[model samples]
Target: MEEERLVTQVTPKSEDFSRWYLDLIRRTELADYAPMKGMMVIRPYGYAIWENIQRLLDERIKASGHVNAYFPLFIPEGFLRKEMEHLQGFAPEVAWVTQGGADELEERLAVRPTSEAIIGFMYSKWVKSWRDLPVLINQWANVVRWEKVTRPFLRTTEFLWQEGHTVHETYDEAQAETLRILDMYRQFVETELAIPVLYGRKTEQEKFAGALATYAIEALMSDGKALQMGTSHNLGQHFARVFNIRFEDHNQSLQYAWQTSWGVSTRLIGALVMAHGDDSGLVFPPAVAPFQVVIIPISIGNWKENTLPRAVELRSRLERVGIRVFLDDRSEYTPGWKFSEWEMRGVPLRLEIGPRDVKNNQAVAVRRDNKEKLIVSLDGVEAKIKGILDGIQASLFDKALAFQKENTCQVSSYQEFKSVIENKRGFVQAFWCGSEECEARIKEETMATIRVIPLEEEKNQKGKCIFCQKEAGTLAVFARSY
Candidate 1:
């Protein structure tokens, strides 16, 4: 039997958000540091959450006219070099496989940081006519980017992600697909993961390398830091032109196909933990929680025989209604211990069935978020669980939205923006001059960078540039990011 643990063992988030994040990850068995620097071994519990996210996201991807496909992980060095800008951007982090078993290879193969190089080459061969224009395919795979600094799932040397690559006949069609997938990503995170994001276009300095435009969903963590949730890029003809990904138009003229690539990585799990987790541990939204409900059978006297059977029955009922549940029937641990463990694991709902509760034909229901206890009658318990889970999902997104709103504010002066970036940190909305020189100078002076140019209502508001006193180019969100 394991020794009993105190809930307060996990670091308080307010005390130190980073330490608290690592503590909760270990406590919940989400991920652990690997011997290799900047690498992580995702525990089964963490992978389960990712699996649920994949299931939900894959469904949406298929519904939106995209299919799954896989490509080579090792790209020839020359392939990455084909696109000069793309090669330059990832050159610093590219891991090269120089040897093949015994003899030294003539050409080093790059472990793909992203598959655009090799994938675009394949598309060049596969696409011959306009009929093959819209190749909407997504691949769920792992990519390696040698990171000097790493954080568990957030910025690992290697991480699992889904990369979507598509080709279109015209610029307009490709641009539309880019935004379409962007909206899909936003909907998935907000509705399924229950993490609200700020949707906007990336500045030239921040956009993906070699991309004509890049759009992202930026989310604010509870610690007043911003995290890039996901990104969609309109590649235009950059890769297609470099790789000869051309197709014969209806007029029989060879034209370069417009392309797009977008992805969201395991870093999302870190975002979820940071956004919704409390001092106790992780608090997952019901949709992605490995176990939405945990059943604890109170073990006192012969309640094992009494409470265990009812707990099993409740698990069966909840499972029948599509609720992911775990029944803690282990006799070694006390019910209180199980409750605390599951609470730390962030099960949205806890149903405790004891001798008294079974006798009273009710179960003690506890919510993980607020730790609210309710005496739920045994009748229609499945429906009640479903409703509560739905409510929990909504409440999580709303709470995160409220937190983002509370932390975010518009600043008019460079002095005020610098102060917020240094002393107080959240999202500071400020005007930008749309100059790369200005952006770099600001980032060098203040660790905060322009997260995204707001495309919503604030983009229309006119104001002077926060730094240079020039005309406003666009409204931008500035923050130090993970």
Candidate 2:
């Protein structure tokens, strides 16, 4: 906590985009690199945002019939090999433990890169018949994926997430469940985190390993690169068959259960930052902001007896109304420094009550999103603050939506696609022939991949493929992504 201020006046988000992000994270104390390579220590402020994210999403998941559960952090190696595709996909990144408590174990245990294999084993034991169908369970935990390269929340080796795994009696039920969770993810991220996302089916090249079909929500960051926000996959009895999760049907025939897996990780915190943060600092949506409002009392002589009490009162009122408010009455820091500090921390709104404000029965409010200032009367200030929080939340989503729309470009050919991808780095809309080879070629040449194939409606237009000169098969959005 005791370090030189890293955020002085360097231009953020313009020329040196990566530096801007690192500076904001370091200066504002969101996170810092840990002792282990490719891992990070999420500071308290960053953890608070994650807590809010968990709260909002957990409520939605529970309401949708999913129950919270826990599974082991390690999986038997044989379980991973049961699904060859999943094993091959995660084999390179898996960490192994061969010794336990000063004894060398006979079989090496794999750190859980994902729980599909272990959950599949449990499902086999728990689900026996249609009466036990639709076992919807979610686990909030940290996973280890030994990544070669990592960024704070984006690709850390160890990060936090909630993974939902469900089993259904029929294929149709599982498919429906997959889509239900996809829409749930879209709504949660857009409304709670203030990040608007593009929803669609993922291309085979990008779909989850071992999944019959994968759906994802893609968000455009401020720097023109795409960030994957969440993903849902229809497992289609693959894990059920492999793990022997069989059940009796209504007609007395034995059948394997249909399965689905979906998750969103701490990577979402990175998306939120890129989607809304500015040069000054983060611009958190009120819904997920640790402190929606920060109260600073601007005082002069004997002000502790005056403005401090008023500031405390206002803080109490705001707190009673369910607003996360912080009163900064520390005499060591000046009023201006407190404002900058809170601004860097991305409090949605700031309330400044000074000697004049106390005498006049008013306070000054500043918005972190736009840096707009308002002189507000103290009377009914709680209601006014509520309105301001809602406004800030909506404003952030609108601004991100507008930015995404503005950066998207529709192209008809590979030439135009390459040109646009090189000149402008946002989403490029083009028709894809639904071929893995063509998708690979395009990525090899332009370094941009299909972010998503917009949910069925965008595929209606008939045209030529952007990469291969074939009849248009599906409309897909392409971009250089993180």
Candidate 3:
């Protein structure tokens, strides 16, 4: 395993962050290249992390009165065309299926880039009265898009995600639902994943297809790039009208229902990796780490035989308290090698027990985030592990928040915006005229687009477009994103 020891082969963050990120993802055994050009295989370690994320998020969704359900993977050709804007937005990247069982099919089917169309059809049938309003359903599934460029979990040809669709009777209720889901996503990212996010609404041009308004939670990566972690859209009556989903009101009138759709994908795993990972490798928060604690027995001479028993006892103690703990008792690898391997996997806390420490009635606990080591007494080790995990979660969030604040900048001039984007590479807070033409021009010129318009637009700042200086309509966050 001499080759595995050569982990310090890349340039540091200050030198080349992109290369450093690619190296960390590959070295940590999180994912690997597959035979498909734009697709990658998520290894067990990476998938385990995703499973933790999914479990927590799924709990939140179910608690919010949403029911889990399954949707078809393929949508008929005409279904997508039900809404013109939706087809226009997704047409460029959709992969179509035109054959079945060695025979040519007359009509093509789209391997759902998103399930809005297919779900809309179901809503039309199930919703006959206002009492049937607010059909909240969520699906845990995989989606496909033929992307021209791909990056692991960030942008892949095929990815795993949960898509939620809901119908409401009133526009206000649907809008409220959209924001509620966005807040749920924001809280989950900040509290569970320990990544701070900026909650906001996307400009009309950046909003989701067929949505009246789109709400999103954006997080700043360590490299100064903004990542849209998740989004919720107020679809309004657009989809309801197209699908002819009319509900009979109490007043003996029929009206179109309001709708909402929201989702968070595996791409969030990529955000966690880039936002918190360091030179050592992944730095996972305790709340989402698959193994929060790993025990490595430090054996020396005759201590090898005697120390193994103490390590087992400590592992049992931790496991009893519901800590996801692992014992590294493999004799083939040295303690130092085991330490590095577990560190690379981002195990939150590691307990190293040796004959001397066991005799002293203590064990050395090391943190993965800061690499701080402390001798913790075995008497209340379970309580101590819980406290340490809490501290790790808070520290990770604080560190990420500080990075975001430092990288975020306010730009007034187009020249300043261009310079900051080219040099700094983070979120740029600027005023905009709220014109799609200006948005397109900025993207064409600097390759940066309006990521989101803040939900709480700064009062009294609505004055010229940041780029064109025409009248400033609203404040929008602009950035080059993944």
Per-residue accuracy of model 3 over 225-312 as CA lDDT, tens digit each: 8899999999999999999989998897999999999999989889888889876777899988879999999878775568988889
- The residue-by-residue lDDT of candidate 2 on 1-482, one tens digit each, is 11123347534566578888877787778899999999999999999999999999999999999999999999999999999888998999999999999999899999999999999999999998999988999999999999999998889999999999999998999999999999999999999999899998998889898899999999999999999999999999899999999999899999999999999999988887889987777889999998999999996888999888999999998899999999998999998889888887889999999899999998999999988999999899989999999999999999999998999989887888998888888999988888899999999999999989988745467878887779876888999999
Compared to the true structure, candidate 2 yields what TM-score?
Answer: 0.97
Q: Among all windows of ten consecutive residues in candidate 1, which has the lowest summed lDDT?
A: 1-10
> Cα RMSDs of all predictions?
2.2, 2.5, 2.2
lDDT by candidate, in order shown:
0.91, 0.91, 0.89
Q: Write the per-residue lDDT of candidate 1 for residues 304-408, one digit (tens) a residue.
A: 677788998999998998889898889898877898889889899999988889999999999998888999999998898899889999999999999989889
Ranking by lDDT: 2, 1, 3
Q: What 10-residue stretch in candidate 2 is worst by lDDT?
A: 1-10
Off by over 4 Å in 3: 1-6, 9-11, 458-460
For each of the candidates, give the backbone clash count.
0, 0, 1
Cα lDDT for residue 319, candidate 1: 93
Evaluation by lDDT, superior candidate among 2 and 3: 2
Give the local distance difference test score of model 3.
0.89
